[model samples]
Target: MAGRIKDHLSIDCNDEGAYYVEARVNHPLREFLNHTDSSYVSQLLPAGATWTATTAGGYIAMIQVTTFACGGISLGAFLSHIIFDGPAATTFISSWAALTRKCGEEAGSPNFDASFVFPQSVAYPREATLSALFSPFLKKGICRSMRIVFDALAIDLLKVKTASSSVRDPTRVEVVSALLCKCIMATFKAKSGIQKSTLITHAVNLRQRAVPQFSKHSMGNFLCMAAALVRANKTGLDNLVCHLRKAIRKIDIDLITALQGDGGWLKYCECIKEIGKASHGTNDKIDLIVFSSWCNMGVYEIDFGWGKPTWVACAPKTKSKIEMVNMIFLMDSKMGNGIEAWVYLEEQHMAMLEQNQELLAFGILEQSPLNLIVS
Candidate 1:
């Protein structure tokens, strides 16, 4: 599938077959699972799975199956974000698992008419405008990726620490995301010796936010980008959570309806402009971190008749260091309530972030997934 961005965004299905690869590792599975380095785990995925246009030799989906010396198997799937969102990918995997297990899975058909619902107009922000607006995120640099797990206990304590009359009962994602933002802000200041205002943008799933709520099986990019600003002095957990909550709430039914209306493109451009404004024009004095939460998306529940997975993970952005920097992918931990954050940051900032005492106080860095299992 190719995403052609001209007058509007449209996906062209070229009937290109999905890419698949099988590999074997000489090392034991336990050896691989014991480490949290993304580069190491990335070996399980098919190399060069990055999505490109069909003419550019890109595949809409890429699959890799790797076997370890100890007979353990790992499955890696890379789906194009242009064509599928988290919920859509989850539905696809679940149905595939059910079919593999011969369970007669009846995963409902997917809805691919998002463009029809939120049709793009001449008012839509052109690719150039978007590129300029989000250029900071598109910069290349020496980036490091790692996973940090926030267990239930830590999350509960965070809720308490961040609880206020104005902000109470913060969701797991909210609290965790806030903490990460706060820590990253501090890390950046310490590294650069200059406190910078931070921009926190979250990818909100539109399936449940829309007025009619798109089905879970709907395909295409059905998401809303919500962002908030945290001044250098207001990076407190409670304050950050408030900002996050408010930004996310702005994507509610009213906003969704507006985005689908005739002036939808203009509304989207306005939102993007507002988000950019939150960072005060994106100079060195401003930091940007993008978050995509896949929590509660049933990622860990995928099974191919071999029982539930011991762990599920998102591959880091190592393959293309130029693509994403200061990004976080949040997914459910094995215990279900906890969140495992897959963070990507510049090398210098990551070196400091990994050693942040305040962050380490509430989160476990690089813990093995096998240890989460209860025998």
Candidate 2:
């Protein structure tokens, strides 16, 4: 019933090297679907971290569609970030979902033209390079995560509080990213040698931002990083949101084009390396936070003929989700208009942040409710 999806994906990644497929029979769907610790991750996942692919088949991509005893279906896919970015992955998932709906030729085509526009001529050692950028803040630390859900009312109130007459309205992403950064930093304020500056890096969509623009169906890594640095005594996250708003707006097509031009990668890398290193993590350190917004990517819109997902959660594996310290993902709330912040922090940091009254005021903490499955 998953018409042309297998073929669609293969063609999408054809130039990336050999692709392999795998199918596995796993646990029943209800156990995974109904499981929970206050939220979804704890309920659905078995103990310890499990890879999206475990068959030891050297496949660049792996996918599975499992039918539940209750007549519901679950679709899972795994892809290395080196080959795809958030937008690219979203396009693929949406396309796959549309196909299953039998949306036909109108079910549509994806544009893998991102790479043709932004060539990967630079041989970036993906993991190593990222670790270098993430290390000072996250390396060798035990990371912990918990789901924090903001209700529609809290989100609306925050939008009002975060806005200023001086600055344009703060976006949902800017508001939430600012909130997490400020709250997390406040948790560490008493620590010795803590820096007063904070940096926020956001993953941006290049489809509409690219010159002349690319279709929403455009695939591959059409992504770039935008960093906002909050320096010394940034009174409130609301204030920081203004700075962040400006930084994100600066990421236009001219910038993307230049970053992709001749010697573009080198210049781009250098600017970023400096951004990470220049803070001079000396005795006085700077606080850094990275966030990506998946709020409107239509993850919950996925329906494999068993009704829309009751809940949509990122794959919160230890290696993939928790290992990246101080990283935050802002996604659409299962509830109508709010946002869910999947916060990954050092255990020590999480403890304090969880108790922050200011945060508690605006964001309700939803610890996963535990569930036992008879697997």
Candidate 3:
């Protein structure tokens, strides 16, 4: 399955932070088989495919790049995690693109060098315990689900907010993620009426764990979870922002400790299981799971010389009942700070959230425009 999916190339780009660039290619199944060649792009292309790129302000741009000889169209999309959390499955797109371009240059050269990746051997203490405690959830098919809903009106409001702000902080990615976390937490508490049961989970990368002198290029899943406890009935956007800032600050410590060859991963899994069990029994699960990352930072840096990607976004392959959201920074040719966020939730829950006009005012919500590409 991995081999089949790694056959295509994808690229992301941006122009002065104004917009994002996205490009993808698809080949007929017969053509693919006949080529008998490996390229980063080819490796990333599944048998049948589709693709899309979402931008900030609730705009979705996409392409069904090619129809495979096998009688199916290749599909793809660029999803922003604000709609779910973290980059989700969109990381595969960039990785695939990198691999494809590399293969194009050196037919047999390995596209990715996993030697620098934090070995599972070093991550064992935590993984072992987590596997023992929460393997059941994985066995029962633990999956993640995400939806990218675009809202024109809300996006307009976001523009207004960005324009009104005078701070020169370039951390727009962190700002948006923080805001989403605040809104989601407020909504969860309001609906559940459990003021005291509020917590937020954030993922942190740990490439600098064992070797502080190591270069920053090391990739793969070198990450850990950070949790924050929120006070009940925390209203107002400013208050929420304050809380988010503090939560983000706490991530550094939590992440380092968790990645120190400790059993932190197990503890994290146990915490999640406890939350799940609590949600099943009393309806009070973690208030919100906020996922955010600066994936767009890698957008322009990745290109196959097809100009640059018009947009970049994220899409998750699985769905879960958990309350989660993700945010991503997208680039477009237009001016101003444009960020795109994807949201997924049950209709009832979403409708109830709509009642909070202030939060809803930030961005518009539209049905996800991306199609799921299942292998």
lDDT (CA) for every model shown?
0.79, 0.63, 0.40
What's model 1's lDDT at 278?
Answer: 62
List the candidate 3 regions with Cα displacement exceeding 4 Å. 1-170, 193-196, 208-216, 253-286, 316-336, 367-375
Root-mean-square deviation per candidate: 2.9, 6.1, 12.6
Best of the two (1, 3) by lDDT = 1
True lDDT of residue 45, candidate 1: 74
Reference-based lDDT, residue 172, model 3: 48
Candidate 2: C-alpha RMSD after superposition: 6.1
Inter-residue clash pairs, candidate 2: 35-43, 36-43, 37-368, 37-369, 37-370, 38-368, 38-369, 39-368, 195-285
Candidate 3 lDDT tens digits, 213-269: 333343333444444555566544444445545555554645455543445545555
In angstroms, how far off is 43's CA in candidate 2?
8.3
Superior candidate under TM-score, 2 versus 3: 2
* lDDT (10s digit) by residue, model 2, range 48-130: 32332222223445465545565555555665453456666766777767787787454446675655665656465443243
- Give the 10-residue window scoring lowest on summed lDDT in candidate 1: 1-10
Error of 2 at 303 (Å): 2.6
Sort by TM-score, top down from the best: 1, 2, 3
